[model samples]
Target: MKRLRYIALGVMVALLAWGYVAFNHWQREMIFMPSRAVGHTPPNGSFSDQWIDAPAAGGVEGGKVHAWWLPAASPEAPALLYLHGNADTLSTNVAAIDRLRQAGFAVLAIDYRGFGASAALLPEERSAYADARAAWQRLEQLAPRAVKRLAYGHSLGGAIAVELAATTPRVDGVVVEGSFTSVVDVAKSTEFDWMPLSLVVSQRFASDEKVAALKTPKLFIHCARDEVIPLRFGDRLYEQAGEPKSRLVIPGGDHNDCPAAAAGEWRDTLRRFGGISA
Candidate 1:
């Protein structure tokens, strides 16, 4: 009986140690689900080919990140630097880009280091932020005289957008949709509620802290029916943000279809915030 007890104790310790290492190693994959195969190109040749120089830390060697720029109907129209969610490429956001285009804003959307046709490598939060900065620089060079420039992000991209808006001096406004306050808060709200995520998780895309520091005009959009990220997260972020902030709640909007659910309201709010003429 004593021998059997010792073996069981050894096995349990080994398993626990393995579990800890494995969880830490793969936590970023669980957070960012990059899909390379399901990407789509821009429609009708309306977009131009744009690329940003890769970050020095990128796993891929000597590669340029891909982006698409769809100019608005007029050259003097306001512009949007759109950062997409974690799972897919910029092509996955074609519809949203189209919506913004129709609302009279030039749209510049990029594929982060790992997603789409940019490069084949795992992306970290810091590298992703670097990619956003590079894209913003390219956008500035491409459209130096844009009437107004806004940073717009959805889901994980919302956190990225908040960071850019807070840090970048030229960004005029910010828009976030279906975004969370922080990765730690999101983990707490999900199945890993019991885990000490703040200690274990490596990525800290804390939008709440960044938004609180921002003084630009802000707009938050959330779907009440969003299952992936609760609407309260968006509300909490809005609360933390400084004044000149607005929010639009789509009553029946899910995580993916909020703009479609409230199309008119979505376009109108963006236009008003961006100061785009009718």
Candidate 2:
């Protein structure tokens, strides 16, 4: 009877171990979805490609992050580090960068490793944060004479922007659109809510916790009719963030079209938030 009990215990332990491993892999797949297929680059030589050399957490700078440098109408204008979402690359965000540039801000849209033309490796939370830091350094180096240094992140990039603002010291402002509080919070709003996902999600971007403690000036934007990330997630983050913060509710805007839907409002908010004249 004792031998049979021991065998049963061993089998249960093995099964649990296998389940944990499998669950983590699934979470990784669900979190970081990268694509090598780039959609398009800017036309008319509007921007230039700038490759940055920065090491990811627990990973080497095998190749480098590819960035699109869109300078403002002037060299002394504010500079923005454009951290894109998991599935986005520099090619997909030309209009986004252009919008900021038109507002008199130099935008550096970066492609993290494993995404566009960057190094091909699976991106984790820490690695993405590392890439943001690298991009920040490069942005500073490239635009040393800029008056302000800001960060703008969309979707998953929003979490990365929050992380960058929390860790960096010289950041002037931060803007996050269609962002979630955390991966767990997002999962809870989905069909997988019943599963115990928080335990296995190693790439958790806990922006809720980090944003609450950050003192930087922040602007949170959410699409009221967002189909990808619920409006509640961005709302929750806005509520959780401390003082020196504001929010914009994009009425009738979806995941990717908020700026176009509210172009005047968006640019006006940027001018006010970043103290820009353009």
Candidate 3:
């Protein structure tokens, strides 16, 4: 009996140690699911090619990051810096990009580090922000005369967009779709709630904190039926934001299709926040 007890104790300790190591190693993979291939194409060849140089950093390769610039129907239309989510490439946003363009706004959509054709080997919180900054700088150079500048992000990109809007002085407005309050909050809401994610998770895209600092006009869009990042997260973010904020709850919409499902309302909200007509 004594010998059997010692063996069981040893096995339990080994399993706990293994679990700790495994969780730390795979946390990023759980958060960011990036794909290497372009999933869709721009409409009618209306977009131009863009690239920005990633800054040197630990675990980052520091190379050119690819982007696509879709011109607005009108020259004086506002411009939007579109930050994509964790999965797939910017090509996955073809429908959203086209919709924004049709709404009379120039759009610059970028792939973060370790995503699509970007040069970083792996993407973390800081590196993703750096890549977004580089893309914004390039967009400024491309459209120096744009009437206004806006930031739009979806899912994981929403957190990045909020950070950019908070830090960038030139941003006129901000928009986030299906975004969470923070990585820790998300971990608590999911199956990993039992784990101490605060100690293990490295990517802290804390939009909740960033949103409080943003004075720009803001819009929070979420789907009531979203299973990935619950609608309450969006509500929490919207509630934390300062004045001149709006919220759009899309009924019966899921994570990815909310924009398409409520295209009219989405465009109207963007126009109202961006000070654009029609």
Candidate 4:
């Protein structure tokens, strides 16, 4: 069976090559360049904000990270600490910020390390968690009298928000949109199954693992036709989370349009969850 032996050897070599390439990709992803943060340079604008710098998570060697603080329409409004997706800058999230502001809440959106005005560094799950904590601490110092603080994250940002909510009791409510259950789950479903992501995904966002531990009210929004992160991931996350959670599914909406499509519904949903009157 010499031919059979050769085939087996070839398969083993192919698998090895795949594993190596996947690992390299993972390493590169860990070091992905952070996008430049865009903002409205305004003397006659919708809103004005100031940037604040703080230490990067995990004690990484770098200057302090950066975040933006946009005051609410009024001082009595609640505040939102927002985390953006992998490729997004704070200005990219201005629409949602506007929405939340219309709903009467101040917003603080921060770029992760290596992103926008923040320091450059490889992003890891724990690192993002630490950065989130730093943002809250900075906000407390900036606005001492603020009553409520909420967390809203989309895609990769959702993973960040979930980790913070599960571990930190100070978060009043959490909104995770277009999030996945885990990186492995996503890899397994994609063409990258040959990568063995389940084995090497070190910074596993592992949203499912922490969902049950979250005690605060959570709102999970997903698009039924989402092609980037399948709707099933959100479904799985929902099934794993504890009480005081709600899932909103937008039919026929893809990943990017979910917010726009469900704008009214999103406002209503967050209002109910945050106990804010519309």
Candidate 5:
């Protein structure tokens, strides 16, 4: 009976230790500032690509931030500031680069600190917001003559885009794809909520609150078959936006494929927002 008590105590202690570890991991709010990576250039290669240094705004640790910019065919062309998803490097988005160019946008995609060659650590929602702001400032400086500026984000990037659209005045329009409602809400829906989620989740990436504050033209695209983030998150976000909002729901596409599946609608939405001839 004494041995049994010892075994139970050990199990309890182990569980407590695991809970503490999970809490710390979730709350390890690291901010990876974005940097530019020189990989494969654009396919059509119409625009000159380069990196610009900007200072981080609203970060836990204020420091220098960086972003990549591509020049347009003409000074009068509209500029696009893109924020990529969470995983992988920005170089992995060559297809998106090609598509944006075809859509008549001078693309500026920034690598959040931890993902690509960007300097910094991991990422938190606040850090992501600061990096995005710094990127936007650089875009303004690089394309001063451009008449319009649009913000685009994908997956995790979508959450950043929504936050910027709500808070920043630099962008005229916003585009988001495969974004979640809120990380905290999503965590609650998962089986891991019993874990110390709030303590470890440094970047909440809360779109539910931000979407309601968006005053600019916004386009949200989501996949009907997305296995990662449910389609309802997009629906909820769309409903929250005040006005000048549109949504594209791909019929059978999953998270990553939704963009390609709804390319026609996506282009149409962009054309409408950017006032392009397309």
Candidate 6:
């Protein structure tokens, strides 16, 4: 009976380990969803394809991330590093980029590794930050003549933007739209609230903790109709942010429609924060 008991105990341990691994994998899938392919095309003479070097991460070999460069008519116009959300590719946020261009800021929007035609690596929080930094380096070279540089991120990308603003030496401003305080908090507020996500969730962006320390100017925008992350998260981030900050809650639109539905507000934001005006 003693030998049988030992075997049962070892089997239970193995099964528990397997269960944890499976749960962790599922969490990552839910968080970092890379697109299957390059699904959309830019208009002729609208934007140019720009590729930035990405160092190896998460065991994936180093490769390049694809980007769309939309330069303003003036080389000295303010620039923005467009870090898109976890589920988005550059093609998905074309309207937002167009609005930024209209506001007179050169834009560089990129697809993180494992998304679009860039690379085939698995997406993770750390890898996304690495990708953004690499893109920032490219933007520095591409827009060196610009008067200033800003970082704009939507949803999960907002968390990455906050991080970039806090860590980088060249960022002039930061804009995070419809983003959450932390991925773990958002998950807890969802149906998965029942799950112990803190233990399995390794991709916690934790923007709230970082936003408070940034001295650079920031704009936190949210939509009243946003059901994905809720307006509460944006409010919390703004409240936690230090001085030289502002918040805009668009009366209409959802998580991703503010650029279209609240076009005037977006342009105004660019003008005030980035010194760009149409």
Listed in order, each prediction's TM-score against the native is: 0.89, 0.91, 0.88, 0.83, 0.81, 0.92
| Segments of candidate 6 deviating more than 4 angstroms | 1-17
In model 2, the worst 10-residue window by lDDT is 54-63
Write one digit per residue (lDDT tens) for candidate 6, span 45-161: 878999888887654578889999998898999989988887778878777777788788899999998888888767777778889999999999989999999999999999999
lDDT tens digits, residue span 55-109, model 3: 9654556778889999876667788899888876877778877788888889999
Q: Please, what are the lDDT tens digits per residue for candidate 5 over residues 209-267? A: 87776788888888899987888888877887778888778887787667687788777
TM-score of 3: 0.88
* lDDT for each residue of candidate 1 in 1-278, tens digit (9 for 90 to 100): 99999999999999999986677558667777776754566687789978789666533343577889999777778888999898868778888878888888999998887788887777777778888888898888877788899899999999999888888989999999999999999888778899778888877799988877688889999999999899888888889888889999999879988999999988898899999766
The best candidate by TM-score is 6
Which clashing pairs does model 4 show? Answer: 34-114, 37-116, 114-119, 114-120
Q: Which regions of candidate 5 are displaced past 4 Å?
A: 1-39, 47-49, 54-66, 195-200
- CA deviation > 4 Å runs, candidate 4: 1-25, 28-33, 37-49, 56-59
- Model 2 gets an lDDT of 0.85
TM-score between candidate 1 and the true structure: 0.89
- Against the reference, the lDDT scores of all candidates come to 0.85, 0.85, 0.83, 0.76, 0.73, 0.85
Which ranges of candidate 3 are over 4 A from the true structure? 1-25
RMSD (Cα, Å) for all candidates, in order, is 4.4, 2.5, 4.7, 5.9, 5.8, 2.2
User: Which residue pairs in candidate 2 have backbone atoms (N, alpha carbon, C) closer than 3 angstroms, thus clashing?
Assistant: none
Q: Residue 262 CA error for candidate 6 (Å)?
A: 1.9
Q: CA shift at 26, candidate 1, in angstroms?
A: 1.0
The best-first sequence of candidates by TM-score reads: 6, 2, 1, 3, 4, 5
